[model samples]
Target chain A: MHRTLHPLTSLCFILFFFVIALFGAPTTQMVGVMILLSAASSIRKRKQAWKKIALYILPIGILLFLVNSAFGAPFSRGLAYALRFVLLITPLVIVLLGGSPTDFRLGLRTVPIPSRLHYLFIFSFEIIQSLRDVFQAVYIGQQLRGYNANRSLGNKWKNIFPLLLPVMLIAISQGLDRSLAFEFKGIESPAEKIYLRTLTLSPFDKLSIAILLLSSLGLIVASFILP
Target chain B: MITIKDLSFRYKQEARNSFEHISLHLQDGQALGVIGPSQAGKTTFAYALAGLLQKHFRGGSLTGTVIFDAQDQAPGTSEIGFVFQDASLQLSGVTETVEEEIAFSLEQFGVPRDIMRERIEEQLSTFHLIGLRYRHPKTLSGGETQMLAIASEAAKHPRLFILDEPTQALDADHVRHLIDFLRVAKRSSTIIFIEQNMSATFELCNHVLFLENGRQQFLGTPHDLLNSNIDVSSLTLPELIDVQRSLGRNHISLLFKETIEWMKKCRTSA
Candidate 1:
């Protein structure tokens, strides 16, 4: 079902969840709504994806809880805040993990956003992903050469410059190469771009959007009524 | 036809030009091999030919007249496809699947969806990427990625193709495949092939341009290049050519197969 949803439909749900997370009352009911939405978005995702989402949320949630408790907040209040943070961030991670950059571009096309802006947005994700891969490769290479960052705290700090210098140089070179590649492909041509796969609102997509709207309305109403 | 005259370029803040006084003329449907050692400005020359040096290198100073007299009117950069040396960097990172990577350029060109599909399928088949059509472009091996890069550019069917050291990272099998592809590609597209391998250059190119220290040392047919006195010791010259040079046999064929046949004839005659 997640695979069949149009990019626009998925984006609509994501925006809906984000708006609720931002504006709704920080109540247990709101967190429950977020959990339901996040679970629905992640239904078709893999276990690895779920672990990634948890990895994103857990450390921050723990930090938030620790900080709140240190500030003399009640245990229940701190736990609730931590849980709220987890619920608020989970859906976004799920959507990002579930969709590819191509899907994001497809979704952006229907909007009146400037083509360059959307292209930049999409390329930022790709650049970060590629840079992460490069950093991992460099890190592993250094580790194999016996430059262990795990040796001590000072060693970790000492290894930072040597590790980052090559990655930064490669990043700059790769950025130039990528821009040239993009130019050769005519990405900025004045011609009206055409898509190989057209995005149409299927019945499933319509249903998804409809469900999203109804769920948001119900959640807002429940938030106002609940204690 | 492509004609370049008095071409020279220097990057901003550089004391000397990267390459200077290089000129060549290639008829339509011909291949020109550009060979030289490192820092000979081979890639810079390629960028100039592709019109990128002027269009993209805004900080650089360029002086030259590059005329691409194609069948159509004045050719824009769109009529030229360039494959960089690094196949990984050449890929459009936004695409997920192999077929999408090929369709990416066509989409930007605003090709009709039906025509785009046809071109994508044709390129996939041509580059032997049909089996990996649904696979992620990032997951492909080095050779497969290189093939995808070439396939993506070839799908454009540009008037000219500039391949910069394409076989550098390729193994023997992939090299043979690339040679086969170029043999077919050269019939339609004028090719500026920058290569280190002497045999592939001699086999695939009609004309050769030898660059050294930012200077055009030689420019002519491969036969003329071999006959010329310009030192080519830096290049990995084919064994037969080396042997011929050592034996003072200037009449030796530039092609390995032809030289082998010549050796057979010599033995039979004796």
Candidate 2:
């Protein structure tokens, strides 16, 4: 819950929770745990909590319930699988909404991914953000240029299509041009080296990592014994 | 310093040279102001000097030599840095933070670990961006973004800085900051400024070079260029320059102190 957790540790915790939920025993228990995590995050930021559950988590839960009811096999078994999916996704949603974009990049840096791929990831993220802005701007521009009655649902959707395609293309081209400029500025040059100072692993990181290791080990032992 | 002798260039698709027989020289520590109507090759000349005409761009045939700091140099020489009119095109950072944006280039040079953090921190404070170091570059006001670009390039410490109408995206306040920043650059580096804002040009540059229709119309000290027999009404000069011109004041000194003294002389003579 503390914001002081290193970005890497937060990422590790989220990934670890999902891996266990997807692969460990008692899927329903994992699902409950996931929902609990999301509910906890929601307490801090109510709107984000509502959005995560409503948009992705709730729909997933409903689908699981329908499937379990129809199949009706170890009724609890179906419920458990559905619960697992919900639990698997909760930590991810919490992490995504918890920090600003820079923290996201910093977390990614802690991973073993290549730097070029990192640049592309950053570039795409900006492109998406810019595309959203461009569409809104174009809509405002359209209204200002004399298209008044845009209140009706059908008219609004139609207005969006015309606005969407052009903005999307412009955003794509702008992204490419910016990427080329970065290349010209030598962002891709391997010869250009940066010295990264070693970051000390904090107690929070050690604890989260320990929890992941212990749970994963427990799952391995239980699966062998139960099998 | 730049000297172009009988220089001519034509884009591959175009029929004629954009400019022919062009020759000009910019002195050290002097700010050169280039003015011309559109399609007059104002940007083309600036590009040619930076060697970007052939390096960064194509579809042009250039036959001329460009000398930088008394030495012939190729495109993107360490001695010269360029600023386009569009600040967005030049800045490369997804994060909104100004410090991260300026660090983009220094990181490229592989600046020593000992200096990187200090340099980044210094630029953020010097450009009045300390408080906004964490703010997004895309969210920054037009002037702040321009200042960010200037700050980024300044960290490189290029000897010759060429700004191609950098004030176009800026407002009155930003324009002044840009001029003031250039005044600081002029103290240590020669600057070639191409702008339609003559008032800005008059305020900062002592040396003026006028380009009209891709031809060098006038090149001299600001005093002679404006005070001579020239139709400057189209130039839309600042009110001060207009009054000086109407009165036939021959010495329109560019130094702020000198201009103040000249104003006294004009009032006394009248």
Candidate 3:
């Protein structure tokens, strides 16, 4: 669905879920949405998406719970705060799992944004993606070199510096290289930009957007009316 | 014509210049091969020729002029295409597929969709990327990525091309393709070809610039660079040249066929 749907439709879907997660009441509705998103990810064969969401949600969620409880908040309040964290992050991870930088740029192009801003947004995502790959490679290299970060908590803490320094240096070098490449490609040329593969809303894309919009409105209304 | 006069550059806080006192004149549609050992400022020379040393390298002092057709045009204004040594870094990550990657530059130039399509099709076929047109750029192998990088730049048909070790990642077959492409490219574009592969330098370039320790060692034809008394021990000379030197032959054959014929004569006489 992500591959076939119009970028605008996907953008709307992502935005709708984000809004719901942000403002929708901390009730079964939010949980339902989270479950639905995870299910969507599963159906799309992004099996690792939910696991990645969990990996992030668990530690931070527990930390939030502990902090709230330590501050004398009720158990239910602490749990709700933790659930809010989960709700906040799921949409972002879902988007990351399904969308590439190109999709983000294409989606942003539908808005009346400046081209420079468009490049900023796209390059930010590109850098993040590049850094992710760099981090993975560095981590594997460290592991192969017997500096196992998983051996113990102490080792994990100790390995952070070695892993981080190279990644940062490589990221900086790559950033410079990417900027030079952009210039070489005439990315900032004064000529008006054009798209070879133009985006068009298909019937399914329209239907998806409509359903998302209605669902979002229903969620907002239900949030106001519900206890 | 592309002309550089007494060009020199020093990186920020560096003790010595990267390369200095370099000058060369290359006619239009001529290819110049830049050869040097590691840290010999070959890439610096390339960046300078592409008009990137001043713009991209902040705080780096660059002296002298690089004029294109007798005009000192601002960077990115002229059609100066550069292919960096690291092919992966050359990719515009905003493009998803190989075909879009080729079109990314054309789109930036605002080429009409029809012409853009024609150029994209031509590049895909020329670079032998038709089968991988829809594949994501990140998923390509090193050689394929290098080809894609070259193809994307080649699609622009720039007036001047600055390629830094463009064949480093390519296999033999792809290297041949690149040589063929460059052979055609140099007919219409002034090319600054920086390569460590001596055979490629001999095959593609009419002029050669040799640098060492931030200074020009020699600047002339490939044949002269090999035949001259200057020290070329740092470079990996082609096997044929090494064999010629070992056999105490003063004359060097630049063509492989001619060299093979000479070897046949020597064997028959023996």
What are the DockQ scores of the candidates, in order? 0.72, 0.33, 0.58
Name the best candidate (by lDDT).
3
Candidate 1 residue-wise lDDT at B125: 79
In candidate 2 chain A, where is summed lDDT lowest over 10 consecutive residues?
A191-200
The digit string of per-residue lDDT tens for model 3 on A1-227 reads 44645567766766776667655766763565556565456535477676775677678978987888786778877777777777667666666667655555666665676777877877787788889999999988878988766668876887687789999999999888888888878777889888787656767878989988888888878878877
TM-score of chain A of 1: 0.65
Question: For residues A1-227, what per-residue lDDT tens digits would candidate 1 score against the true structure?
Answer: 45745677777677666556644665643565556455645556657556865576778888887888776778866666676676667666667667765656676776676667877887788888888899999999988998777778887888777889899999999999988988888887889988787556778878888887787787778777876
User: Poorest 10 consecutive residues of model 1 chain A by lDDT?
Assistant: A28-37
Model 2 regions more than 4 Å off: A3-8, A27-47, A54-56, A71-73, A110-114, A148-151, A164-203, A210-226, B15-20, B69-72, B75-80, B117-126, B130-134, B169-174, B227-234, B247-270
Segments of candidate 3 deviating more than 4 angstroms: A1-105, A140-150, A201-227, B74-78, B267-270
Worst 10 residues of 1 chain B by lDDT: B70-79
lDDT of each: 0.82, 0.70, 0.83
TM-score, every prediction: 0.85, 0.82, 0.81
Q: How displaced is residue A49 in candidate 2, in Å? A: 3.0
Residues B20-92, model 2: lDDT tens digits: 6777776777888887667778788877776667765576788866666566765354346577667776787
Query: Which candidate do you rate higher for lDDT, 1 or 2?
Result: 1
Candidate 1, residue A71: Cα displacement in angstroms equals 11
